[model samples]
Target: MKAWLLNDFGLDNLQPGETPTPTPKPGELLVKVGAVSLNFRDKAIVDGIYEPASVPKPLIPVSDAAGTVVAIGEGVTRFKVGDRVNSHLYSTWIDGAPLPDAPAHCVGMPLPGGLAEFMIIHETSAVAAPGNMTDEEASTLPIAALTAWYSLVDYADIKAGQTVLVQGTGGVSVFAVQIAKALGARVIATSSNDENLAKIAALGADALINYRKTPAWDTEALNLTDGLGADVVLDVAGGDGINQSVQATKAGGKIAQIGFLGGQTAALDLMPLIFRQTTIRGIAVGTRTSFERMNAFLNDHVIRPVIDTVYSFDQAREAYEHLTRGAFGKIVIKID
Candidate 1:
């Protein structure tokens, strides 16, 4: 099977090549990949910035993908040929908390991921996608949507009438806005431009802030929420937004830390957190159960993933470069 293999840790090292098409063992399924989505982490892996030192040599990168089941191995009863599925980010963590190997067992990391013609994954690993979505849309779910859902629903227990703040217009951030609105919370989205702000509002964001224009967007969030601050803040900007997210959040509110788009580390003040009794959680993309639950929500709400662009499978390298430059919504690759 043809694949974009990471021979060395660099974008130039990603070459078009052929590897053996994997055969499903017992309790597994072979999927004919239809599309793959690019996340910021995929670019980091190619650029040698993502340090998951355990992945084996000659890796297939890009974690999230949607495909059709072409073959089912013995004891694989959950799905069969023709079933459409997406690869789970964590193969071993079926439910609940992260399993011991979950970090190392992630797709596009230790496992041969979906940027290939086919993939052999465990039957219990992935879940059915929303019926209304195209394969490209479903490809965005495994990481981006699941991360947003886990942060808003599982961690914060968001409710109606609450103000939820989401930073930037990245994949997880957009998904966070949609999920928060679906759960009845009023969403406040931040972006640097008027165009992205309008798009965010179309996705049900009740309030919008031009973070670039208004550097003190935290104070703005507080003002929008009637000086009470947000009940939940999805901080996708990492170091750049940590202090401000603390300021935007209500006392006893939760902050779900999901990405490092800004900087990896930040100097934080513990005094405000102590005084406000706020909680901060570091969210990794969630388990298969959470993926399934997220799908259920998408299916019910008929929420389509906002795709910014699509590239052909052969243009994988160009796709990586584009993703590194950043996009307003999820970028996908169609496997033809």
Candidate 2:
């Protein structure tokens, strides 16, 4: 089988290579990967920044994929041959809270990933792909979509008419906007680009903030919400901006800390958190159960994922490069 392999910890090391096709063991499925989506973590892994000591060299590097089950192991029951499925990010996290060993068991890291033509997946670690979506679209769900869903639905228990402030036009933020709208909540989107903000508006964002134009976007968010602030603020930038996120969030509201695009550490102010009782919850991707629930919600709302670009399997390197350049939504690699 053909695949891209990371010979070492660098983007240049991710070159095309040959590998044997893997067969499923008991309670597993052999999926013919149709498409794989790139995430920030994928880039981090390639650059050797995300848990570099733990990453196995000569590994395939992509966490989320969608494909057809070509074969199933002896005990497999959830899916059979010919069923479409999406790869779960965590191989061990089945339901509820994530298991202690979840981080060590992720796909595209210690385990082989979807960059290959075929890969083995445990039956419990795969979910039925949405019937209405193509493989490219479904490939975006395991991390970006599920993170947004887990943030707004599972943690926040977001109700209709509540305000959700989506940080930017990245994959998770776009999904956050669409999901928040589907849940009947008003969405306020922030982007450095006005064109991107307009695009977000087309996706049902109630208000748009050009963070570049209005440097104090937190104050703008408060004004947009009649000075009460957003019911939930999806804070992707974890640097100094996190302080602004607290200001943007309504009293007693939640801040879903999803990404660290700005920087890893921040000098966070505790006064507002203490006074307002704001909850800053760190968001891991999500559980298998949460992925299933998100799929159902997507089907009900007819919300398709926003795809920024799709590269061929051979163009995997280019796809990673594009990810670093920043994407409006998701970047996918199609295996044909």
TM-scores of all models? 0.97, 0.98
- Model 1, runs deviating above 4 Å: none
Q: For model 1, what is the C-alpha lDDT against the true structure?
A: 0.89
lDDT of 2 at 313: 90
Residues 211-273 of candidate 2: C-alpha lDDT, one tens digit per residue: 999999999999999999999999988898999999999999999998988998999899998
For residue 133, model 2's alpha carbon misses the true position, in angstroms, by: 1.0
The Cα error of candidate 1 at residue 145, in Å, is 0.6
Worst 10 residues of 1 by lDDT: 48-57
Q: How many residue-pair clashes does candidate 1 contain?
A: 0
lDDT per residue for candidate 1 within 195-293, as digits (tens), equals: 999989988999999988999999999999888899989998898569889999999998999888889999888998889889999998887888888
